[model samples]
Target: MVSVHRAGALLNEASCFLCRRRTHHHLRFPTPGFALPREASPSRRSSLAAPFGRICTRAQAMGTESYTFGPYKIHPGEVFYSTDLSYAMVNLRPLLPGHVLVCPKREVKRFVDLTVDETSDLWVTARNVGAQLERYHRASSLTFAIQDGPQAGQTVPHVHIHILPRKPGDFEKNDKIYDAIDEKEQELKETLDLDKDRKDRSSEEMACEADEYRVLFS
Candidate 1:
């Protein structure tokens, strides 16, 4: 048998749990066959919806619902692939035809700043993005590089792995790609500054690019 008590009130002739005194306003026990209507309580509906809400929130955090990188809150159309730990997107500037970047969800400056799991996921994601880029660009090779810090030529403060698909004669010299990195980054900055009309890719363009890459990754 269960007993419940309210302030100065006894239930079912039971003593008040707090005051230890029998009082009026006793509650009668329900008969065995009696039950509340299924739809009568809002709490039941809320309980049922809670898991679905949690699932949506989890999906949003994991990049299924949203994609964000550095200061940019990326549109869904810009994200080609994503995992719980990291996501891959098309590069704003391309050293090669199919260059892309893979980065952890949290912003960090250097490789050493990443946790063990993030470090592992970063490389794994980079590798996967490399393979996909290769197939998408029909390239025989790929260049994977990380500008670890400012001294190493990292333009963005956030840690990112650049995956550049390469083909023969793509660069006059193999080491020229390194020089191209600084040149391309500078050019992008200049374009953004000098060209007021220049803007990010439209939703339709990003969606199309994402779809093309998604097929390659698939």
Candidate 2:
């Protein structure tokens, strides 16, 4: 049932539920199964449509990926860096080539939740990949960054650091494209979960690791 009162309450805040900021918006809920005591006026319908359109537009901008990071069973491909205990990949973003994401197989939501060894491996993997980027991709520098939550602009809750290879002229050095895309990359990470597990680690070690074990099995 569509309650006018409830709708009014939601509108009173005038904030987007997804982004959570005060903004004038409206959405037309399909009314087939909903009870409506009063018909929506033309102005009301128009107002709702605009915001709904914006929401859909923003959603369509973020494309979904087929797979997640960590140990997973798939066709064997190029292995970037591995410790027999962890692994990483060159992120698809490729700001200057050799961009990689270091993540655990376990589905840990926050950096603080990672077990000690997993935490160590995360940074170590990133560091190793960063060096390889310098040696192989000839990048002048590498940047490591993590977004822990939505407020921090972390779209995906999964903890991962972006290793971007920087070059002298990659950007005008005045543009903030990297930062903007980095935020989107985090969202992309949140949408996928790694499917494989690291077997070399003993059950005891795996237990202590914060990698996503259940998602791999399920």
Candidate 3:
């Protein structure tokens, strides 16, 4: 997010800005099985107590295993929601409350690079995730945005849709809060300066929030 001074410019100059990144996570339904990386939380570790075979899962395995945005590796334990084609995860530095990202599993850099199925699935997943977040965050509205390419301010070379839960009067100017893309990915400074001031949330903090969000999907 941002301040009122830059809000107006953001609409025109930014054009489109979504979240920063996406990866793997727990696929709540079909398996209820997600393998935490070797150094995962105790609770997430318990999820893999069953067997190594069950834990041999991927995001597409109806369970969150591990995946990547482009070259950046994401911790599997922190992703809370995903489908066969897409995933929704907590932002390391969210623009607003209940802000999250939904991305296709396949890391296609450009929006046009996605096939019809990936495009359809990405939007549908964003819609479903947004609806749940709206209810959970008890917000009045939501903003769904995507930065299609470098010119559009895409940073990670991956396609991601930002889902920001909005509330009245939350911002001096509502758009101010949505200043940049996902703050998390900006740490790597893949492309733009949308997020240059903030520090990142610790892995533990991310995993903790992700654990809480998983209930919304389950």
Candidate 4:
């Protein structure tokens, strides 16, 4: 629970986010210096196009934006896009080429807990990111899904929308992907304690992919 004084200070910093993107001002502050990404020059972003394999070591991204998904701390490099309220991060174990997750910054476990503003920003972020992914992946369609809660197979407890860019006939059956998602989550649950190390694709892999996607927004 945030006090009035803290909330007021947040509103002051929110002007930075609102100037570039009309994002909500009341986003929960999980960490210091976590905010909407500042604009990067094309030359700075161009390096993102290179394959991750080319780089020998994993380095934190030049961008300052960072976020979390449930108990998992999302690294800065893995975050591609963000509004004041929400951010998009690559899936560690994707069912498709361009599968990603758009999550609210608040770490709200259930959808019902979301403020109206958070709800609106979450979907808007999804819609915007889905379009970019579809174009980038050159897919014929997309899959937008939300598990919503534990009964609905929500892993990690945080509410998130999964966006998968689909090509024709590649993933013909709908149930298959959802099944895969469930199965994968089950495997992760057994192994990961949900404390920072929520990785399947190495951090470098997710970071490189995010860097590529960052180019779209920049």
Top-scoring candidate (lDDT) = 4
TM-score of 4: 0.68
Candidates in order have lDDT scores of: 0.56, 0.44, 0.59, 0.65
Mind giving the per-residue lDDT tens digits that candidate 2 earns over 1-218?
86998876565334223322111211234231111113333443322221211221111111232234433321112233445445564333233334456777576778889999999888887776677655544556777878776677766656778776665544444246446555546534442343233221222211111111111211
lDDT accuracy of residue 35 in candidate 4: 17
Worst 10 residues of 1 by lDDT: 49-58
Better of 2 and 4 by lDDT: 4
Worst 10 residues of 3 by lDDT: 49-58
Lowest summed-lDDT stretch of 10 residues in model 4?
22-31
Error of 2 at 98 (Å): 1.0
lDDT of 1 by residue, 56-139 (tens): 111122234665554556666567788788988765545444567788988887789899999999899989889877765567
Q: Can you list the residue pairs that collide in candidate 1?
A: none
lDDT of 3 at 35: 19
Clashes of each: 0, 9, 4, 0
Name model 1 segments beyond 4 Å from true: 1-64, 187-203
Ranking by lDDT: 4, 3, 1, 2
The TM-score, computed over Cα atoms with residue i paired to residue i, of candidate 3 is 0.64
